[model samples]
Target chain A: MSNPESFRELCRKEIHTGPTSGVLPGYIQANLLILPKCVAESFEDLCTRNPVACPILSKTEGRPQFLRNHASLIKQGTFDIRTDFPRYNVYSRGKLVQQKNNCVNEWSSDHVGFLIGCSFTFEHALEKAGLVPKNVLYNKNVSMFRTTKFLDSAGIFHQCPYVVSMRPYKLTEVEIVREITRKFKKTHGEPLDWGYDGAKRLGI
Target chain B: MSNPESFRELCRKEIHTGPTSGVLPGYIQANLLILPKCVAESFEDLCTRNPVACPILSKTEGRPQFLRNHASLIKQGTFDIRTDFPRYNVYSRGKLVQQKNNCVNEWSSDHVGFLIGCSFTFEHALEKAGLVPKNVLYNKNVSMFRTTKFLDSAGIFHQCPYVVSMRPYKLTEVEIVREITRKFKKTHGEPLDWGYDGAKRLGI
Candidate 1:
């Protein structure tokens, strides 16, 4: 993978459409959600109420363009959101309709976009602490489960079950994992649980 | 000054339009902004770029009803946004148009609202520390100055001067004030600078 900027450029041109794993090693990658203005408020509320599941990276109201440069770049209108991401999961009225390479055709004047913090950021920190994240070792996407734990409902997003990504670790390492991830409050801070009974508590 | 719920009820009934100072003591009060979905993204970007000037408490996509309870309430479709605020400053194309006790008429389906952290939260900490915030001492609104500091431009909010609310303190108490305020990162965190030269440096 090239530098983040060049990687984004390639994505902008539709040359890359796969998972962004191991790309831009030290830089952050985010989960994307775009919705109509009518439902944007509910989504924002959902993120706020469930900070651990939906830690926000950045959000845009109705603009289709995004900033490619780091937060320090003062100038406006840097990147086009329509074609920048590797892939987008498109939903309509709370149903997954399709996954698209780019959302250019789906973009609308009333659409709002959110960049949510992915757990991948803290996974890097775990590796540095001499702890191997299970997913990385397995060479698979992180295991995600829909838990019976209900998210605090926001406007249109009522009573939705909380979704959590899972990674297994030895019982002895649980405290250390919690300590390291807790420091990143913005990136789904800390593990929800560690062992088999822990998973049972979440109803996974 | 009553419990936050009752105070909100009074505001909803159009009885309380005064400054929220000393009302619902120990409960948080917020700075409110309501904008059409058109400018919402720019404002979100503006907040992201200049977090110190605008630490957001909660934002809604297009829902007019704010949470009557604190952020913990999850059930949807709660308070109405129109008559809930003690006051609202209306803006058209980035210009202040009117300050209204209620914005029921001005709010459209296309509008989004933001609850931003007010410096008042830290003022309590200041008072507890034996350092009286200048505004509270003078029995006036906090002194706000437009600085030469430029906020990073977002979509429609371009090259806007950063606005800071000020409270003067003795040189000896500067570090103490900073230490106390730094804990409230969600609110405007700490003094950007202290002393007469500090104000001059910000081009206030």
Candidate 2:
């Protein structure tokens, strides 16, 4: 059970009870968004448009208990969208309504799930390169701000404010950070804004 | 105005009416599929699963005149899902009903468009790498075969045979070809199989 796959098995068995972060280092972890099949495409469009905030790793419909969705990528198994994770926040009608350790009852046959990427993946690369971000140095959560920027609306999805994640680096280190992170486009590649002038550009 | 963008401008105005191949050598060309919003997610899932046959570059809904999606990528303008392409084959009720240079009348606000990648993009990469495909050497169309393999079915998109496009190379050259093309994952990313055994494996 030392490997991430075995760790996922523990998660499936409800034995490993904690957040998935840092458990699966060097492997891409995902932020999950499950929705009814009816609005799946529209929300996918929103995520595609706002990739920095919602870079999609994989998406599928009706396949419960699975994440990476190609038939080639997955074996017949349990990814139970409901029980695979340690915990879940249930949203209804665009609002967070409840929290649960297991969401098996919340899932339906027509549900679609998106596995999105975040800064977590590339932050490892940053750490390996010795460009530890100020957030980590200070032991603080990455600063996140909702920019006035909005994603283009898709069907039934409108006015999505593009959220930005901020981690400060020395101005001298910005170029190297960009060089390291841009290669991982799936994980929000390169900062959207940085330094004083870059901050001004995003109007942060 | 000699670049691909200007070429697309010509396409938008209907001044260019020919197959969009080799015109923009360094730029990515796409195969377009548009469907009503109702079944878009199902089809997208199918494509995502069968990426070698249908590598998606971008997809969008509602923005009728676009190809590369995302609010960041597009300005309000005309790629005219219909008029931007040099030609189109219109399918109706599961049959190819008509071929036209202009499909404007066929589009509606509810339509979703997917821009899929093909061997076209990486073929350029191969040519640049000095490993001209046998198809190009013989000046013939790339050989395409419908394998018994089927794409993982999605809603309303079922029983789809996974198509394979074959372009031969010397056995010794296969690895180099693979190395060159694999980086371009958007464009099918390397050969599915290679050499005589590879051919036999496909039962072609």
Best by lDDT: 1
lDDT of 2 by residue, B1-204 (tens): 467667767877778876553456667778888888888876775565455567788886567665454546665663466777777889998899998877788878888988888677777778888987777665566788875444433445655655788877788987788678766667776566667755564456
In angstroms, the error of model 1 at B119 is 22
Clashing pairs in 1: A40-B61, A41-B60, A41-B61, A61-B41
Writing each residue's lDDT as its tens digit, candidate 1 over B1-204 gives 456666777888779887765555456678887777877866875675456677777786446664423445633433666777788787776688998888888878887888888888878878888898877777678888997555534445654766888888779887788778766767776666657766776666
> RMSD in angstroms, all models?
22.1, 21.5
> Whole-model lDDT for model 2 versus the true structure?
0.69
lDDT of 2 by residue, A1-204 (tens): 566557667877878766553455577777778888888976875565445557788876456755554556654673566777766889987799998777788888888878888687777788889977666666556778876444433445655555777887778987788778766667776665566755554446
Task: Candidate 2: give its CA RMSD in angstroms.
Answer: 21.5
Q: Given candidate 1, what's the lDDT at residue B33?
A: 78
Candidate 2 chain A worst ten-residue window by lDDT: A147-156
What residue pairs are clashing in model 2? A65-A79, A65-A80, A65-A81, A66-A79
